[model samples]
Target chain A: MFSGLSAFPLTPMQHGVVDEVAFIRLIERLADAGVDSIGALGSTGNYAYLTREERARIAQLAEKHAGDIPVIIGISALSTRDVLALAEDAQKAGASAVLLAPMSYQPLSEEEVFGLYETVAHNLSVPLCVYDNPRTTHFEFSDELHGHIAQLPNVGSIKIPGVPAAPDAASVRIERLRTLIPSHITIGISGDPLAAIGMNAGCEAWYSVIGGLFPQTALAITRASQAGDTQQALRLSERLNPLWALFSQHGGSLRVIATAAELQGLAASPCLPLPLQGLDKKGRQNLARVLDELSLT
Target chain B: MFSGLSAFPLTPMQHGVVDEVAFIRLIERLADAGVDSIGALGSTGNYAYLTREERARIAQLAEKHAGDIPVIIGISALSTRDVLALAEDAQKAGASAVLLAPMSYQPLSEEEVFGLYETVAHNLSVPLCVYDNPRTTHFEFSDELHGHIAQLPNVGSIKIPGVPAAPDAASVRIERLRTLIPSHITIGISGDPLAAIGMNAGCEAWYSVIGGLFPQTALAITRASQAGDTQQALRLSERLNPLWALFSQHGGSLRVIATAAELQGLAASPCLPLPLQGLDKKGRQNLARVLDELSLT
Candidate 1:
């Protein structure tokens, strides 16, 4: 069910409530940009910060606004019971597949990680995509663990977090993973700046953060790289390097992306939940310069 | 408000509910063992896994059983809003002090971490102890950040996560932290194995996990070390080293402690929340043997 570029939008919030109108508009915009799918609650989607009820509302909004495009709703929680509950909710809300990350407040053992996916997978009729984003979840999936997870029932796709520092090494790693896992399982890549390299390496899809806000750019890069137009893909990646640089420096793109969205007049505020304040004054200046230079504004 | 050994009991759960009867018994046992204080909802207390309502109940139970001993309630949450709310509840439950960890799902900047404590501190009348447990919270407090947090209003103590690897280095680190912060702010040590080293280095208290289950052992170590009986303290610490080895190897003590608790017949089951399974057969055998050798059963 995974292919091409899947846009993951920021969960826009206004005064602590999810801004439903803005969220619907963002999904509609991504759908109109002709992306293959919409991921309603990926890392960039701020799934951890919101309540279950709020996340349920987001799933409905994504499906309502995404038109015919498949909607992959991120279903992550600290407990297996909560994950299964969210998966059931996602399925009821017309989600194409639910993205599962091994998120635990406590670091999970290998057996525990498997139990989480296996139990949740057993409950879901909709296909489950195993999301491997170590930066946020703090649980790194070993190549061996990936092999084990691939054999689980109802798990149809794998979203491999990109090795941004070394794309060549990532390509080699991706090749080995593909060889190890079942060919029936769709392999997708995330990490916006490195998506070009991953797509060039023959990964089937791009689970993209940047694409949610600027789908045309992400889609173009995926098409160029998949079509063997390395030059075009690299050029596009270079153009977005400033934004990627900000994401790297800040340790995450949630704040940077939200800031950019607000600067470009897309969102109401760049505010994240308190204790996670957005970029500083100097950061805002740099972000503004990058957006203006790229004509994103 | 902090001295000697403080016990942190695991929140016993049965059939997906907090076992209030078992919880009260655990607290009463700790008080009987003459622990300096009872820390409800410490890391072993499984504060993160519990709901707000469940946490409130635990606080009331802690106060009910902890007759004369002080009760230090752990108040940690992803948002400052929730943290404040929990702090208010902790105060109402008659807690002597509230332990606060800069708990964030996202990595926080130095400014944000300071703001979290400052904002929460303003609302909390009870003294706040800055809890620096990086392994669980994933947010490390540098010496500079510790100094900053110590200066916040109502902040009267700091719980420094002990570095058990290098006892000498940890002692030096503890000393430097003691000198950097105001003398009024009590310094406590956590991590069962390193508590002796921390106390020997002049840290006022041992925020002990093992103390909850085996308070006699922890208190003996504390009393011996605090009274300048290094040889006796070292002997007690060495006796508990096997359990500490399991904690160090596993990167956490939650499951290991739970297993030992069940083996000693304190709790009915070592069952942690689903997907966080307890020790395997080999681990259980090892833990049982250790407990038996120590005569803790």
Candidate 2:
């Protein structure tokens, strides 16, 4: 169930409030595109910026709108108690699996992180995905630590940051993790730009940012990678190089993705939470030009 | 208003609830020790682990027990809206100033961070202290960014990490910031181990961790430095070298600080929020030995 393409949607916010209508529409769009799983409240979803009430409602909305697509809800928070509470909410809202990132304010120690997963994993009814997103959560997981966490009960998958760019190096990286992680636990790849390489490198799934907006585009890469068509996957990924460049230039993907969603009329203007003005005029202009060139506009 | 020795007390918690009595006792200890200010909800205070309601009550308790000493509340949150709300609560609770760190799950851009300070600073009735805690917050601030933020009104101080180990280097480091920041805006140094060095290096204040619990000891260093007795200040810092080394070995100051407070019978055992174990048995033994040698226990 964890294998294949998992799309992370932006939980569109309008004027500091979750745009429930737009949010449901995003879920439906991903469902219509036949994505394997819908990752709601992932980093791109602005889950950390939201309150529990809003998050719980969003979880329900995702479940209601996702049709048969499995819903993986992000339950990351600073405190373990809060993470537990959010996990419970996600489970109640019919999440197929829950995603947990070591989202922190005080940079966490390894023991604390393991304890968090152990305690949360012990209590979970649904399987848990260890979200090793150093870019946002700022917690780097050692391979040994991931091995330890993967042994916890209800641990079903690990969503890792992108693999090495080179094909041989990417295979070696995943192979090392594979030796430690259990076979039941699927390894999914994030870092939208490198999704094709990671998937082609034997990742069971692509946990993508662009997949949330342009599922068809992301699927083209995912399906090719899955079919052992390495050339097609690489070719498709190269086409979106401009978008990936924008993501890097902007520091991260949330802002860039927000702009793309807004441009596509899928979300409101200034859809992101406060203090995160989506993209400046210059960035937007560049994005529009690139999207037009790629025929993704 | 943001000068001398500002003691940041822990908001002691018991079984996941704020230990009001113990928290108040810590506040009284700082106030009785004649600290220049009481910095409630600082990192040592575990501001990030707390809920908004927990934070608001902590702020009120801090103000109530602090007597005439000005109270500085840490109002940091992931969302700007929440930070603004927390700032309002702090002000309503009679805080002299509010401290904000760009604590993030999505690693923030420079503009997002500046906008956070700008928006929060504009709304604040009290002064705002820019909290540059890269160790905990994981957001690095450039000197140019500091210069840009310093121009915003109500930005009364910047709680910098620490200065260089060498006297000459420390002086140059603080002096460089002095040129960019407004003269009126105080440059306070944190990192408890280096507090004395920073103070002697011309830092206007010591935003201390140890001072939160051992106000008298920290003040001895602060007083010597304020008197321009660099030799005595350095000597005092050198004496506590064991404790500083423990903090480094243990990853950060909070857990070590929590252990010391617990040993002193000042806070409940395991006072830190869950997932942040105060210290393991081995770590505790090491800390206890160091505290005993320092005659702090």
* Tens-place lDDT digits, model 1, residues A228-274: 89779878888888888999998877889888877777787744767
**lDDT, residue A179, candidate 1:** 81
Which is the leading candidate under DockQ?
2
Model 1 regions more than 4 Å off? A164-168, B163-171
**C-alpha positional error of residue B266 in candidate 2 after TM-score superposition, expressed in Å:** 1.2
Candidate 2 lDDT over residue span A1-297, tens digit each = 688989999999888889999998988889999999999999999999999999999999999999999999999998888999999999999999999999877778899999999999999999999999988877899999999999999999999998999999999999999999999999999998888889989999888899998899888888998989999999999999999899889887889999989988999999999878888999999998988898761
Per-residue C-alpha lDDT of model 2 across residues B1-297, encoded as one tens digit per residue: 799999999888898889999999999999899999989999999998899999999999999999999999999998998998999899999999999999877777898999999899889889989999998777899999999999999999999998898889999999999999888999999998888889988999999899999999989888999998989998998999999998898888998999889988999998999878898898889888988899751
**Candidate number of the best TM-score:** 2
TM-score of each: 0.96, 0.98
